[model samples]
Target: MNQLDQLKKYSTVVADTGNVELIKKFSTQDATTNPSLILNAIKLPKYKNLLLKSIEYAKKKNINLKETVSLASNKISVDIGTKILNFIPGRVSTEVDSRLSFNKNLCIFHAKEIIRMYEENGIKRNRILIKLASTWESIQAAKELEKENINCNLTLLFSFAQAKACAQSGVFLISPFVGRIYDWHINKYNLDSINIENDPGVKSVKKIFNFYKKYSYKTIIMAASFRNINQILELSGCDYLTISPTLLSELKSNFNKIDKKLNFTIKNKTYKNKITEEEFRFEHNEDIMATEKLSEGIRQFGYDQKKIEDIIIKNI
Candidate 1:
């Protein structure tokens, strides 16, 4: 069997793209989308109608320009997610606006809005994972949403503290950005290249995987933002690996036998105190890499979010 097929035996493969064609091609179990991916996907000729439809939907709301753009952005995300869901049997992760990441109440409200849009399209809440940033506010918002049976995927996760907080908050999943972590370490060390064995990104995911498995946390770890196939192969046994089309294509052609790099076996059960909000903030701030990358990820996503909104504004 190909490596992609082999990897699926160990971990659920999630397509990390807004392009439905690629998602269909990979046959990923689940799919994830952010502002950037959604922006890129809508640019393609195939999605022009999708964009037009979203604009029309937004116009019907009879809101102001700013509110109309917001509605259209949410509609585009949900529309793309709804389309992706038709191809994948599992859930689709539609991210909340990163601009609302710092506002717990806004985050909660936006998440529910996305869920409502999905449900209106005949998609069940269980088939949607409302993606949110890994800010403290977002985490708290997720905790509340979970109580209402709205599952969430915490994105832009870089620190162990973030992972701990998310799991403790009873989130459905957390996406630790593997490639971003690797990039930070590589630039910090001024290294030309790093081997997969010593890669910081790979190590981070492994640590989180072991910790979650040891404690038997039901919160899933879906490794995201991979730089290459080796990183994906290294995390073969992760709960889920969200891979882009480029890397997915690489895995699809490779026939190498990939071994499970992570496992559920824990010799001894371990326990730790629940992470407090203050502790999460302090520890996460201490990690320079996580702090910088988390901020950078949010800014990038917010920028892309605006770009999509601009497009909607132009058409509407």
Candidate 2:
């Protein structure tokens, strides 16, 4: 079996792209998409129709440009997610607008709207994971949403505190970024490169995995933002790993023996204390890498969100 097939034995492989066509080529169990990915996918010739459809939906709403842009953005995300769901048997993660990451009510409202759109298309809520940023507000929002049976994937996660908070909030999943963590450390220490075994990103995921297993937290850890095939190989036994099409292709071409790097048989001591909001903020603030990367990630996604809105305006 190829490395991709071999890795699936231990962890669920997810396609981290908005391009449904590329996702169809891979044997991914789930698909994840952010504003940036949605923007890129809509730019492709094949996905142009999705954009046109979004524009048409916006025009029917007859709202102002601001409201229209917001409506179209959610429409496109759900439209693409709906398309992806046809190819994969598992759920599709459609991200909330990063611009609303700090607003709990807005986040919840948008998430529900996205869910409603999916349901209107005959997709069940159980087959969808609403993606939100790992901000405190977003985490709280997810907690309430979960109560209503709306599963969420807390994303842009980079700190142990963020992971702990998400787990305690009873979120369905958390995507701890690997490549962004590695990139921050590389530039911080001015290192030429780090070995795969010693990669900071990989180590972060391992730590979270072990912690979750030790305390028996039901929240799933889906490692994201991998920079290389080796990083994916390093996280062979995570709950899930969302990989780009480029890395997915690389894994499909390579046939190598892989082993489970993480398991539930953790030997670490368990902790029963819940993470307070203040403690979570302080701990995450202390980690310079997480602090900077989280902000940077939000900004980048926000920029892409604007780009998508711009395209909608042009079509209007």
lDDT of 1 by residue, 103-184 (tens): 9999999899999989989999999999999999999999999999999999999999999999888999999999999999
How big is the positional error of residue 118 in model 1, measured in Å on the Cα after superposition?
0.8
lDDT of each: 0.92, 0.93
Clash totals in order: 0, 0
List all candidate RMSDs to the true structure: 1.2, 1.4
lDDT of 1 at 125: 99
Which clashing pairs does model 1 show?
Answer: none
lDDT of 2 by residue, 154-265 (tens): 9999999999999889999999999999998899999989999789999999999988988878899999999999999888899999999999999999997888877677
